[model samples]
Target: MKSFAFVLSILAVMGLAFWAYGENYKTQRALSEVESLQGQIGQLRETRAVLRAEWAYLNRPDRLADLVGMNFASLGLVPLAAVQFGRVEQISYPRPDALPSELQLGPITGAVTVSAPANAPVPAEDMLIP
Candidate 1:
């Protein structure tokens, strides 16, 4: 009976040892995967930095101007002048179509604050001339 109990205990210990060995390998694999991902992230970050530097180099105004000059006949590019600008009031905003007659505005219940008196004189700074 004692020998049987001892054999059972030994088997239990062996089973546990095998389970722990499998777990250790799984942990090692997970660590390797994490390291590989970190290496890829570092490579991507380096590539992004190099690309940003290249973009800045290519977007230099002088280089762009030279390129534009070379393609001017085909591009028909023109310089901007102050006369090209327009006043905000000159913009023709598109109005949304009216809802079907069946739909109407809901009741307004929120508190509305009037910032300035209706009779107050207009401020020069608030006016837009152009």
Candidate 2:
């Protein structure tokens, strides 16, 4: 009976060792994947920085102006002047309309209530702004 118990304990230890070894390998693989992903992220960030620099260089106003001037005959390009800009007051704005009020949860009222001004326009199923 003692011999049987010893054999059982040995088998248990072996099983534990096998499980631990498998888990260790899995952990190592996951760590390696994480490292690889981190490296890719770093490379992507570097690439993004390089692309941003290139974009900035390519979009320089002087460079763009030169290109436009070279192609002006075909492009019908016009030079911008201060007079081309408009004042904010020139913009036509939409009239103020009643927007849906926020819902309040309290012990006094369990139901939801939408409050709007009496002069508010009838709520449309679909609001279109054009």
Candidate 3:
């Protein structure tokens, strides 16, 4: 009986050893994958920095002015003038009376109720204009 118990314990130990071996490989695979992802992240950060530098170089004001001057005749491009701009009051805003009945908000509840069909297009009269 004692010999049988010793053999059983040895088998249990072997089984546990096999499980630990598999777990060790799994941990190693996970660590390798993490390293690969870190490498990709480093590459992307480097690429982004290079792109930002290139963007800054391309957007230099002097370079843009030179380009504009070179293409002025063909592009018909002209410099902006203060007189070309319009005053805020020059904008023609929609009147409140122009809104449809369905778009009007309730006086007491202040909730909007649309009488139109569910799939019907809603008017933009109630929307705030920038």
Candidate 4:
């Protein structure tokens, strides 16, 4: 009976050790897979950035203008400044109303400084600061 119990105890210990080893191997493999996926993700992100830069370069205004200028001679459309481009100030404001409109009011605000009432609670200096 003693010999049988000792053998069974040794088998149980061996089984526990094998189970722990398998678990460690699984963890290491998962870590390696995670690292590999991170590298792939980084490379793909870099590729996407490069593609975006190229797309911007292709759609640049100067390049499009050059292409249009090369092609417009065949179209025979006479482009003028008023048609092709206009300044914001020229478009936004008319000649007659160049100056801002005169604000009509009850003359509430006066340009010249006036003295406050002698009995005023706050002095003019204190009121100005506040």
Candidate 5:
């Protein structure tokens, strides 16, 4: 009976060792994948930095002015002037009396009608109390 108990303990130890070995391999594989992903992220960041530098070089104000000068006869491009701008008072905004009764600031009383296209899907009605 003592020999049988000893053999059973040995089997349990062997099983635990096998499980530990598998877990170690799984951990190494996960670490390798993380390293690969880090390398890819570094490459993408370098590419983005290069692209931004190129964009800045291409959009220089002096280069744009030169191109505009060369193309002015065909493009009819002209510089902006202050006289072209309009004053705030020149804008025609809607009057308070012209608005619908429901749109006016008041206590909530009934359902509000929202205009939508005929083919548009209708949403479920929700009541809003002020």
Candidate 6:
């Protein structure tokens, strides 16, 4: 009976240790996966930054104009020379007096009448505002 009890105790302890070791292995694996994912995220961010810079370079005004000229030559959007551009002061504008001044009034209402008392002191609030 003593030998059997001792054997059972040893087996229980070993079983507990094995279970703890499995849990520790799983935890370590999860931490490693998290580190790998962090590395991948950083790489993706760097790639996105490089792509944004390349996109800006591709969208430059001169490159866009060249692409349009190649793709849409029939649009007739010719580039102007310096001599073709006109000064703003050389543009003509219609004078305001050229507009007709026709009177068109709506129905008028009677004005309200109020008489002030003689020798009344000016209100203190009105003096303060002015």
TM-score leader: 2
Provide the TM-score for each candidate, comma-separated.
0.63, 0.66, 0.64, 0.51, 0.61, 0.47
Estimate candidate 2's alpha-carbon lDDT, on a 0 to 1 scale.
Answer: 0.80
**Candidate 4: residue 46 lDDT (0-100):** 100
Maximum-lDDT candidate: 5
Candidate 3 lDDT, tens digit per residue, 1-130?
Answer: 9999999999999999999999999999999999999999999999999999999999998898888899998997776789999999999987766878766554443335446788977676533222
Instruction: For each candidate in turn, give its C-alpha RMSD to the true structure in angstroms.
Output: 12.4, 11.3, 7.3, 11.3, 8.3, 13.8
Residue 125 C-alpha lDDT in model 4: 41
**Candidates 3 and 6, the one with greater lDDT:** 3
**Candidate 1 accuracy as TM-score:** 0.63
Give the range of the ten consecutive residues with the poorest summed lDDT in model 3.
Answer: 105-114
State the lDDT at 107 in candidate 1.
49
- What's the C-alpha lDDT at position 7 in model 4? 100
The candidate, 3 or 4, that scores higher on TM-score is: 3
Looking at model 6, residue 26 earns an lDDT score of: 100
Q: Model 1: how far is 115 from its true place, Å? A: 25
lDDT of 5 by residue, 1-130 (tens): 9999999999999999999999999999999999999999999999999999999999998888888899999998766779888999999988877888886555556676567778976655523423
Positional deviation of residue 53's Cα in model 4 after best superposition, in angstroms: 1.2
- By lDDT, the better pick of 1 and 6 is 1
Is candidate 2 or 5 superior in TM-score? 2
Per-residue C-alpha lDDT of model 1 across residues 36-116, encoded as one tens digit per residue: 999999999999999999999999988988888999999988667899999999998644346554454444554434356
Candidate achieving higher lDDT, 2 or 5: 5
Candidate 6: how large is its RMSD?
Answer: 13.8
Order the candidates by TM-score, highest first — what do you get?
A: 2, 3, 1, 5, 4, 6
Clashes of each: 0, 0, 0, 0, 0, 0
Q: Which has the higher TM-score value, candidate number 2 or candidate number 3?
A: 2
The 10-residue segment of model 6 with minimum total lDDT is 104-113
Residue-level lDDT of model 6, residues 1-130, one tens digit each, is 9999999999999999999999999999999999999999999999999999999999998998897788675776656579898999989876655645543323345432344568876564333320
